[model samples]
Target chain A: QNSDASNEPHTVKKSVLATYYHRKFEGRRTSSGAKYRAKKLTAAHRTLPFGTMITVTNPDNGKSVKVKVNDRGPFSRKLAIDLSESAAKEIGIYSKGVAKVKLSYTLE
Target chain B: QNSDASNEPHTVKKSVLATYYHRKFEGRRTSSGAKYRAKKLTAAHRTLPFGTMITVTNPDNGKSVKVKVNDRGPFSRKLAIDLSESAAKEIGIYSKGVAKVKLSYTLE
Candidate 1:
């Protein structure tokens, strides 16, 4: 019911976790296939060195969050990281439930 | 063991949930709180109307997040919102583990 898909021009290739946020609204299951929360700062990735710090910012609200790459994510081509619901709310994206955020890796 | 206690000059009397964030660093337990996930947006509160929206900002990095008041918290006099570990990370406070943040309520 929303038409906020105009700025997806870049279409960069991401891992399975890239599109993880869509699961909350779509009721999709995780790879280990357990229920995921959209409020945490946790994210899924194809393969990132563990302990890597990732900064995610909501383009609309300018809310930024730093996430530590902990475990591996289900390898896919669409998603990058699966954010916890609280993490989304911190960046003001939880209400809309989906946001186009900037994902950058910051070395520790 | 820490010198961050100087800001307690105007300590306000908050409900049970007010001093919640300290639990993680202090290894304190929550009331009836089964091992809670620090990554979720869920928060424990004293008494605010349900569905109220609250804005929490990390004073250090200026990172901010919006949270929905869901359940009532332990009736203590120290903590406010117990942020998930992920939420703290987003605001750049997880490593330090504690932050002084501004809390505001916004009408929906």
Candidate 2:
């Protein structure tokens, strides 16, 4: 049984350290732990530790929001981060779908 | 003693049942419980019970993903639901700040 584990293909590779976008869905859940919430100003970075704060900015409108890194994601190839519906609207990203954004870590 | 509790400004009001968008931060955390992860294909809604599954569809690209409603949010007047970074990219919501989408509650 242990031999088969090594034979499995490691499909997980880190893409852009992180990316940004509006509200949409296109990923799968790998862990079965507790769920995360969208209403809270939170985000998911693959490498960032949980509870890390990051500033998310909308390049188009120049609107920015500080979010706590609570989860992990952007599992697909087409998008980056998923904004809560409210976060997208607050930064003026909901109209078009996805926006150019920059996420910077906030020192705790 | 309890009179002040209810007298306190009831600023909390329901907005749009729910909404959609890309990666951004524009809300606040109401609870101090365990944090939510964005990369886990999860979302936050005000009324959805924990573990409720919902389908988030990107109206622009027509991509959809199923997510579990695990938190509450959109505390600001700007956004609706927040997406995980990965989910946004998968559904093509990362390019735009936010997308026109529909969230349907899945019957468990």
Candidate 3:
């Protein structure tokens, strides 16, 4: 009985197509009702609840960033999450427009 | 200057010992005068200025988190940055209490 294991958060991991928000989206209200700021570390998921935090990683470069889910996005079923401009840049994919990333989220 | 390169943000990178805020600091006012909330992705740095955002990565685990510099100090010269609870958790160092992390910040 490893009690600490149960006490710790449970994680659900997935591989997804990552894209970033455009500057135009700045000042727009997100699904969570928060204004989307290009420089904030935030993201959008199809169905994750507001305030859910996810660790997104570009495995190729081992670059990762934790982003808060504050909107619903990517709209295309093929894409998983839409990262904020700053979040994407941190993972070295802002200029690329898109990339494959590993998403790790905890159930809290 | 390559026009695009000049227009792009510049990065400042460093390796630091990362510690996280304790639950007791849940409602305390940070140096930036904002109440510290453990669930929010935020961090404290000695001199990066308020509102600066940093991408912190645990290289060993390839996990990272983007946190805003909303507070000040670990107070110890040997320590570099103080991350929030959720941020630390995202990087798999919540229970560890401390770890070495690579910090990347963009100068816009």
Candidate 4:
């Protein structure tokens, strides 16, 4: 049974380190051409298309927030998503500065 | 003072009819190529750029929800914005099927 399980196409939930956008970037144009707003629920992902909606969950507190992918990067090899200030707050990560998160998306 | 006010570039908040996306479209592709999820806090605006975030306010109850513009159109001349199911619920419009809302966006 263990060997069969290993051979199966198992879907593992990926966890990544997350950080948030700085207020300094507010009003600046993101790579996708939309002006970044710190108060908006938005995020930056390296490969997700602009307008992609993602659920970012903070495993520590079981809090989660939905953020739209509108810009490009955290630029750090260690991070997976860069959320806006409001997005981070929604998931209880604003006060912490950073958190380990699991990302989820629905397939079409 | 009235003449001066008339001459000034006065910004008037526009109010329009708003509706929510149906759950049947949950996994379909939006105009921006991202998959639509009815539970996400997103909206469809005719002219707004993809990824633009707008504050949708339901003036009757003074409730509001921030939504990202990810798709296009109510396709009706009378409607201004179409919220996702969750967005509609956030602003207390989900049960009504439609609501009159004021749209606001910040300039860069």
Give the best candidate by DockQ.
2
| Candidate order, lDDT descending | 3, 4, 2, 1
Mind giving the per-residue lDDT tens digits that candidate 2 earns over A55-98? 44443344445566555443443333344554444444466544
What are the per-residue Cα lDDT tens digits for candidate 3 across A1-108?
Answer: 113445545556555444555556768766566887766777665435557766665444565677777765543423333333344445554455445554432111
The candidate maximizing lDDT is 3
DockQ of each: 0.06, 0.07, 0.03, 0.02
* Candidate 3 Cα errors over 4 Å, as ranges: A1-8, A77-108, B1-108
Residue B11, model 1: lDDT of 19
Where model 1 places Cα greater than 4 Å from the true spot, the runs are A1-108, B1-18, B21-37, B77-108
How much is the lDDT of residue A102 in candidate 2?
34
Docking class of 3: incorrect
**What fraction of the reference interface contacts is present in each model, in order?**
0.07, 0.06, 0.01, 0.00
Query: Which residue pairs of candidate 4 clash?
Result: none
> lDDT, candidate 1, residue A26?
30
Off by over 4 Å in 4: A1-108, B1-12, B77-108
Question: Model 3 compared with the native: what TM-score?
Answer: 0.33
Residue-level lDDT of model 1, residues A1-108, one tens digit each, is: 124465542222211112223323233333223434546555443233344455554333445565544433322223222233455546554555333443322111
For all predictions in the order shown, the interface RMSD in Å is 21.1, 17.9, 21.4, 22.1
How well is each residue in B76-99 modelled by candidate 2, as lDDT tens digits?
333433456554444455666655
- Candidate 2's clash total is 54
